[model samples]
Target: MTQRTIKVGMLMAKESPDLISLVGYQTSASAVLIGLDRINAENLLPNINFTFTWYFDECQPYKTAGYLTKLILIDKVDVVFGPTCPEWKARKISGGIVL
Candidate 1:
């Protein structure tokens, strides 16, 4: 089978620091990091490398929108996935991709 190689970027809401401090967040981050390591070791993606960055905002709608813009534009993410607020998710899915 042909392997798929793709670059992945992750972004969480400014509120992510709060969630990441939780037990669940630590567990989840551990799992994802391990999983990605395994995938990389298996040579499933020869040309792929994942890079991560954190962005924070005041947690206001417009401020969040501004952060998202900087994330996409300045960070140059090929694709973004995350632990975002419901409202942030809605706007990002609807219009964030285009920007």
Candidate 2:
């Protein structure tokens, strides 16, 4: 069987200095990584392999836009998951234009 690698871009929040917040961030990031590991271990996609890069956006609109552009244009990621914040959602559209 032929093998292929899919590049995935993940946008996670930057870790906070507070202990509680840091733990939360770590937990969230770890969940995604664990899920990926499970998929890879099970060979769920047959001959397909998945690779990911993490980008910390701090859930800021400008940072999210910049990182997303880099992920698409420079990183050439096949898919992206993240920036789970209402601010990013708002930035997704502006003045009737999608950004």
Candidate 3:
């Protein structure tokens, strides 16, 4: 079977572009990458492909909502996850499922 690349936009409350190797909240961005790496290593889901990208939207509710919209529409991501905070999660009407 052929696998298609899945573009994912990751939104996090504690990520900074300048801090590429930094660790923060729940798990570091690096850890997410490592998790994906492990999945790839196992070849457990060969039919699925993943292309992950990260987004940092801070802790503001309104800004986070807007950022989420942009990631879904403009970035054209297949999914979005992380940066889990109930306040921002409540305001969203669309886009990728949160965790």
Candidate 4:
């Protein structure tokens, strides 16, 4: 049997355009990817494969909402991660959307 690929939407604040790394393995989009990679490597979920789509929050509340909307409505992601800043969290969580 073939496993289904799961899409996880990630939102992160790009503080500086010159800064290539975000949070340096502490907590950020890259950190999420590392965790997912470990899960896949360990075969923890058995028949499910996880993949990611990312959006930059840019540390702005209003922009974050837009990114969230795109993730939930357009991308139709199965799960969402990042946008770590609670202030930037979207008010819309309806329509079976998981935040």
Note the clash tally of each candidate.
Answer: 0, 0, 0, 0
* Candidate 4 wrong stretches, greater than 4 Å: 16-27, 92-99
Candidate 4 lDDT, 1-99, residue by residue in tens: 889889888776556443336532235655677877888789888888777788776655676677777888899888877554556245443323553
Candidate 1 weakest ten by summed lDDT: 5-14
Model 2 lDDT tens row, 1-99? 888999997776656444326434577678877987888788777888778877777766777777777777788888877654546443464213323
C-alpha local distance difference test of each model: 0.56, 0.68, 0.64, 0.67
For each candidate in turn, the TM-score is 0.59, 0.71, 0.67, 0.68
What is the lDDT for 72 in model 2?
Answer: 72
| Model 1: per-residue Cα lDDT over 1-99, one tens digit each | 554444444444334456554423445457669988998789776766666655543234665566566667777666655435546554665464663
TM-score of 3: 0.67
Could you give candidate 3's per-residue lDDT for residues 1-99 as a string of tens digits? 787888887766565544333334346666777887888899866888887766565655666677677777778788777444446353454434443
Clashing pairs in 3: none
Q: What is the lDDT of residue 46 in candidate 1?
A: 75
Off by over 4 Å in 3: 14-27, 88-90, 93-99
Better of 3 and 4 by TM-score: 4
Give candidate 1 misplaced runs (Cα > 4 Å).
1-7, 13-18, 21-28, 57-60, 88-99
Winning candidate number (TM-score) = 2
TM-score of 2: 0.71
Clashing pairs in 4: none
